[model samples]
Target chain A: GAGVSQSPRYKVAKRGQDVALRCDPISGHVSLFWYQQALGQGPEFLTYFQNEAQLDKSGLPSDRFFAERPEGSVSTLKIQRTQQEDSAVYLCASTVGLQETQYFGPGTRLLVL
Target chain B: EDKVVQSPLSLVVHEGDTVTLNCSYEVTNFRSLLWYKQEKKAPTFLFMLTSSGIEKKSGRLSSILDKKELFSILNITATQTGDSAIYLCAVERRTSGTYKYIFGTGTRLKVLA
Candidate 1:
């Protein structure tokens, strides 16, 4: 893909169900980022990965929220025991070279009901 | 914690009108300020400002950074209906080994036809 690509444009999950959001960054991009955007709010940093290594996960709200990029090219964000507060648009972005310009993917909108 | 604040939560303007959006930040070891335009899903990259007094322009959108004031402004001239979107501002900082990015609430702009 020319830009970052995320799977499942929209998701509806029930309480306590686990949901996994996938992201395929641009080819050869070294940096990948995940953000969570709530309704009427800006996107909040969830985690960052530099070539398959999770350098920072401090932004993850709780232990239930986990992310992995085992192969460096693709990533996944998983939320365990879904809660209403976890509903939001999960966005993925990738930057080429250093952390310079980021290209965003059409986010996966998750709604927990 | 890093903080990014955007002013004028929402704005409406007629076509051809000019508008200015403001963003202020407070972060430790601030490395750069970035501006993005989010319409429905992804937030497209707009500009990245690192040094003071450097203005970035593309078409009718122009942005400038003021490191001394810890603020930045995005200006749009001759606005069109297509310009309606949520404009987000973010600040990137160096914390730990990787960079930390924090975003503001964003300003929603509606350009009337």
Candidate 2:
């Protein structure tokens, strides 16, 4: 892909439901990141991956938030038992390598009703 | 705790008017500052500043970082309606051999025609 891409541009889930969002980074990118953005707020770091290795998971907010990059190219972010507070935009980004500028995807807006 | 802050949560300007956005950060091991323009869900890269006092520019958009002050400013000259969007600032920090970005709550710029 020319740029990072994410699946389910929008999602509406009932409280307590689980939702999974997908991201396809640019070809051969070595680093990927996940973030959550609430209304009128900046994107908050969630997790990071260097290749297939999950080097950092410090930012995941809670046990319900999970992310994985099995192949180092595509990643998935899953939220368990979604809550109304979880309504926000989930963004994915990738960089050619560590310390490089990131390219963002067209975030998935999850609305927990 | 690493944190980023942006000023002027929202701005209203007329076309052809100039605007400046501010970003400040307090973090350990700061590496660089980046600016992004987000019109929808996706935020596109604009500029990256690594050296203090050196301005990085592209056409009507320019940004400068001041490490001593721990802040950066993005200036847009002769703005257009198309330039109306959220401007985000992020700081890259390296810690424990891992890297992450801390973003500020972005400035919402509205250029009226």
Candidate 3:
């Protein structure tokens, strides 16, 4: 229960609609990450944040995908004009330091039709 | 580009059997390698290895890293039914003064009673 938590474990959205997935990392975690896992595949990096500053987002597939961690505690991943290819499990992880073990949330499963 | 590769995509074993999972990576600015076990939801951290030749063990699960060879292995002895899940391997790399993970597709294990 003290681990990372994610909202809307499952979401179904029609194509061209927008969707937002939220992640609440463990208390005091300084590093946050977002990843997308396609069916039967390992998670691919999406973005990274330290405290409230987003440091890397090269993994984002396109400009339509956006993520923010305004206060450094919680993060939100938004996808505009969702497409069928966007259906996957979005996972969030956090750690105390760069080299520390990452703690992962349950992940938000999105299905775009 | 950073990449992680896992071998033997799927395995089926019976109780009391021993299994080994392999992960190989090629990345820039390597930081650490991590192992996680995923069931139906979140992936729980199992081990994090930074230095080579040091084996990290917990219960019947153990992992070792070889930075020189750019690979790692996870071994589980006397496997049980509860061990049925996906084992993921991720490599952390420092980029843009931050860090991100490159994950392997994962090895799916099924243990029968």
Q: Could you estimate the TM-score for every candidate?
A: 0.98, 0.98, 0.97
Which candidate would rank higher by DockQ, 1 or 2?
2
TM-score of chain B of 3: 0.98
lDDT of 2 by residue, A1-113 (tens): 48888999999999999999999999999999999999999999999999998889998989999999997789999999999999999999999997788999999999999
lDDT of 1 by residue, B1-113 (tens): 57999999999999999999999998998999999999999999999999899899999999999999999999999999999999999998887779867999999999999
Residues A1-113, candidate 1: write the lDDT tens digits: 58899999999999999999999999999999999999999999999999999999988999999999999999999999999999999999998856588889999999999
Clashing pairs in 1: none
| DockQ of candidate 1, scored on C-alphas against the true complex (2 decimals) | 0.89
DockQ of each: 0.89, 0.94, 0.92
Error of 1 at A35 (Å): 0.3
Which runs of model 1 end up more than 4 angstroms from their true locations? none
Best by DockQ: 2
Output the lDDT of residue B3, model 1. 90
The lowest-lDDT stretch of 10 consecutive residues in candidate 1 chain B is B92-101
lDDT of 3 by residue, A1-113 (tens): 49999998999999999999999999999999999999999999999999999999989999999999999999999999999999999999999976888899999999999
